[model samples]
Target: MAGESEYTYVVDFDGTITANDLSLELAAYYGGTGYREIENKYRRREIPIKEWLRQMVALLPPDLDQLNRKALEWVSIRAGFNDFLDQVREQKSTVVVASDGFGFYIEPILKAYGLLEKIEFVYRNETVTDSDGQLKVINPHAHKICPVCGNCKAAHVVRIKETGKSVIYTGDGSNDRFGASWSDQICARDRLAEVCDEYELSYSPWEDFYDIIKIEKPDLKDCSDISLCLPQGQGIKDGI
Candidate 1:
């Protein structure tokens, strides 16, 4: 018999994990008008994310303390993440938080909520302040298309597929468009639903992620956390 294919849940941070858009929130909170213009360029793909961010950072006033502090203050993670993850563990499922965003923000945010260690992350790097008082985004590049992401959602989706497992993806913004395209099953909200509609893909709309726990290990609805009971166990997390 074939072994069970591991179930991987790939999630995006910024808009998806957090209830608020951290990038724009940080940009506008500290960067003001300059941030808005660069944001437009990001949406239009007029400039690469690195370049767009470079220009945005240049405009930030030279107040190291202010930028560092404000970076995390305005961002808001979803209300039920802790509960959602608890349920994932209850179901004994593996979870990966993937993004094109920096860890400086991601790491701290997770730490704030005591979730950094519960999952592994694949993402870009943290920010640094150059001696000249300019900001630098220090991170390795992503896949050709992923680099352009507001959060590199698609690259992680591809990585999960390469593992030869069944994947479930979730998100709530245009950032999710590329990632959702490759998912075996998708749960979406806001613009992500719009993206799925345009692409003719099937997706479920979710208001909060506790709904995700209910659907874990898809073949085992209403079963205990370990739903591998032989009756519901056929195919289970194992792929076709």
Candidate 2:
């Protein structure tokens, strides 16, 4: 079968892949006082997410090895995720991880799960040491006005849609908001589920990914059949 003819899935790394956002968890573990300050600023809208990320990274020591070690030690792949991924593979669906978070943890976590090579693509912040010996946050796209805390998931939606492939998205936080808004189907939990209800978007709360492997619902549910379906004109491309 042609690979492009197969389905494509874009997953959010933090809460979607694991149980929580590794970047947020990383901040609590590494950023110290500077992290709290940035969080408050973001909550208050005192700074745009782009600038906040710029500032947040400025506070971290340029310790790539240390960060990688910590991520390997504490980060976890969500329950049932590996099996769900395998099911996707069995069906010839491509899986991509698009994250606003840094790549330091993502690469290692996927490696730990033996999924690093299988993932189709990864979009995230790069790592570099700054003049002050702090890790610098590098945004290749230098985005502006992200919908979530510090990055724009919407942009990823646009990129994925450009391929004109059928896409499925799974996530937990509002970071997946605009992206979920564009998916052919979406599975979410907690805040994102609430967002779906409020916006009347197509979505369902996922307990874990075991159902994805064993059940037929997620892969078969059509957004158009639901009352909460987004308008025909929203999302990454022509909104279809």
Candidate 3:
């Protein structure tokens, strides 16, 4: 029942939209020597992203303004991202940004590049200072039952799909596999591509957003078999 032009591009922030992973960079800059240990744990899959955020936040200073300032200075938008946004707007398609990182600087970074308004939605977690004056990560968009991602990108993909819009997921991290698995098409790079390969999922490798613009908008397919989560049914994968 959806129009031919009804398509949603579910994009990842951090390394996907920006040239570097701001979250990782920030954590490394402020988290100091201990940052490497936490990061290694995450890379080894010993801890999910939600747990990573909790542990990482503990190392960051409680001054959000200082963190935001650093993020603005270090943020760099990926090549062709602005053009891709223009093309999507011209085609009447939607762009939704999904990030499972620290997430406080996403808006500031996008607005700095004058691309915030181009996106239809941003699904991300919040970094807040608790009553005890410590920085903490709050996952308002997380899956209630799944402890994997701080912000459940898979749920965002399924929500758009249920509205009859075809979704094209784009990302560059290992955590992106969950959302990419639910998408009609996957545009992956870096760790995301590696994970897709590991899972035997079909995906297009991309270096920049220009490559994304050239990717054919895919027709909606039955993704139940390949998806890690059944949004309408039993929720996340059995062991995940």
Candidate 4:
């Protein structure tokens, strides 16, 4: 079995870590009621995800600052996430947050929790305010062929695997399908779990980061001697 340091975790933000999906929340709150209709079309496969993302962005107001503030105020991470990061740090493992959502809010949310430096890298869409004060998305990591997720999580996972470290992916969204396929191990829940089921990919179902730590570091499950894991009975809320 591979030890903790032998793995590189490529994780998803939004629904995976946060108690809710920030992008969808932003769209529903700021993008208007029609946002759900557009999302439904994408979910139903009536329209491509690229177009769905574009339409969602179009619904947001021009104030990037306001959006960032709203995200900071509303964003809540999974319980025991801090403990998981501590373990990753102790093992010196690489953990990357790869998401299709814009980074404008992600950066701030991570910073707020003092977990910004704990992440090895972040791959996501860049957001900027144009001269006309409108929100614009800059996708540097998008694959021209894939056209679904603005940022290609699978590409990053493949690159990490080339470094000789096993990749472990954790996610809870449809956008994670390709990346989950590329990972050596998958820690899935909610929507991503359903996707894994359809493809018959073996995965470890998780309710939160605690479940992940248990599977990834079983020896540390009862490591109360170390402050690496949360105290038992201190349960965390999971929206899913």
Candidate 5:
């Protein structure tokens, strides 16, 4: 039974865990006028995500500190995530976050919410400032043959699945399609749900972590916590 329950959860950070897309939000304000066109292109599938990201990042101001500050100020996470993490930790489940965005802002934001240490690994583009103060993106997990994503979430899932643990993937974007397809179980929301529908892939749809807990892992639903669970009718809030 112990071996049967061993699960590794690969979650998406931006939209799945958070209520809003942090990078897109930041890019809207800081990415200048050129960001929108690239975003549109990506949305239309005229440009691949990797190139779209490159064009988007090129429009930013190269101030990592300011970018971090804006994210801390504007970004928020989905409700009940801490409790979800609590349950995962209690079960000793491995949790990994795969993002199509940058980690420069993700680290600080998670630290602020006290969730940094709970996450085993974060797979995303490494954002660094050059000597001239220009931002550079380094993708260590990119697939040589795949041109879509800067970091291949599917590849990570495949590797984790090789270890004989069930891989449960949670995400809410078009980019999540590949990874979610390879997972043993999928919890999808928003756009990813539509993708699942289009492909006829089985998935659990959720509004927030509360839905995820109530629907997928009911055993952990009654688990106790103050900030993690809310009274009936108060409704769940978004983000950390």
Candidate 6:
């Protein structure tokens, strides 16, 4: 086995590890046509992910068990994830999953696949039934003042880096940009790749975790100057 290293992989849960986005699948499955309206707003950048979750959750049914069951039935782990975990374990590197999605189903899905224990931590939002008996989204991981992402993935990356671990942020959504910008290296795909290109951030395009395992660790650099948000500060760029 390779000896332990200073690398920590901060991965996205929805589209990165899974072949499909479970949150989107759940919302579309239960939210009916309303899912498109909210999704379009997020894609157009009119609303941040935090607002997206709030609006999307309202469209979902309040039954958590039913929702989780559907999620378990629909989720498919992407190819190479198991081998990637084995490689990470051999190298003694850390893995953390961060997501801005519905959040309630993450653990259940991971546990179902027996992958939950391999992860060092998971940062995500929660969907709960409010006192009024409505399903609502709660973000304990969000920035106190920043209403951008429900889960501040950038903050998670910054925290890991503070522990002297170099982070490799891997994701496939536009909302992942903030966190990816703070990471030492970025493994981007789909919308996240486009965002990285638009912002002039260097990233490696990947199709699956197998490609991720082959990526070389980059030299640590100060990414704050090019990063989108300041995790230690207000969490968003000016005018955003």
The models' CA-based lDDT, in order, is: 0.63, 0.66, 0.91, 0.76, 0.76, 0.90
lDDT of 5: 0.76
TM-score of each: 0.76, 0.78, 0.96, 0.86, 0.86, 0.96
> How many clashing pairs per prediction, in order?
2, 0, 0, 0, 4, 0
**Which candidate gets the maximum lDDT versus the true structure?**
3
Residues 69-92, candidate 6: write the lDDT tens digits. Answer: 988898889999988988998888
**Model 4 spans with C-alpha error above 4 angstroms:** 217-240
lDDT of 1 at 11: 80
Which digits, one per residue and each the tens of the lDDT, describe model 4 over residues 32-85? 678989988988867755677778888898888889999998998998788888
Q: Report model 5's TM-score to 2 decimal places.
A: 0.86
As a whole number from 0 to 100, the lDDT of residue 224 in candidate 2 is: 37
> Taking the tens digit of each residue's C-alpha lDDT, what string does model 1 give over 31-138?
777788888887775776556666665666566456546766776778778888877666566678765443457777788778877775646555677888667666
Model 3 CA lDDT for position 117: 98
Worst 10 residues of 5 by lDDT: 220-229
lDDT of 2 by residue, 68-118 (tens): 887788776789887777777778777888776766678877887798877
Candidate 6: stretches off by over 4 Å? 1-3
Query: How would you encode candidate 3's per-residue C-alpha lDDT over 86-189 as one tens digit per residue?
Result: 99999899999999999999999899889999999999999999999999999999877776888888888988988888999999999999999999999999
Candidate 5 lDDT over 91-202, as tens digits, reads 7887899998876788788889999899999898987877887787788888765566788887787677667677788999987877777777789988889878877777
Clashing pairs in model 2, backbone N/Cα/C closer than 3 A: none
* Clash pairs for candidate 6: none
Model 4: per-residue Cα lDDT at residue 205:
94
What's the C-alpha lDDT at position 78 in model 6?
A: 92
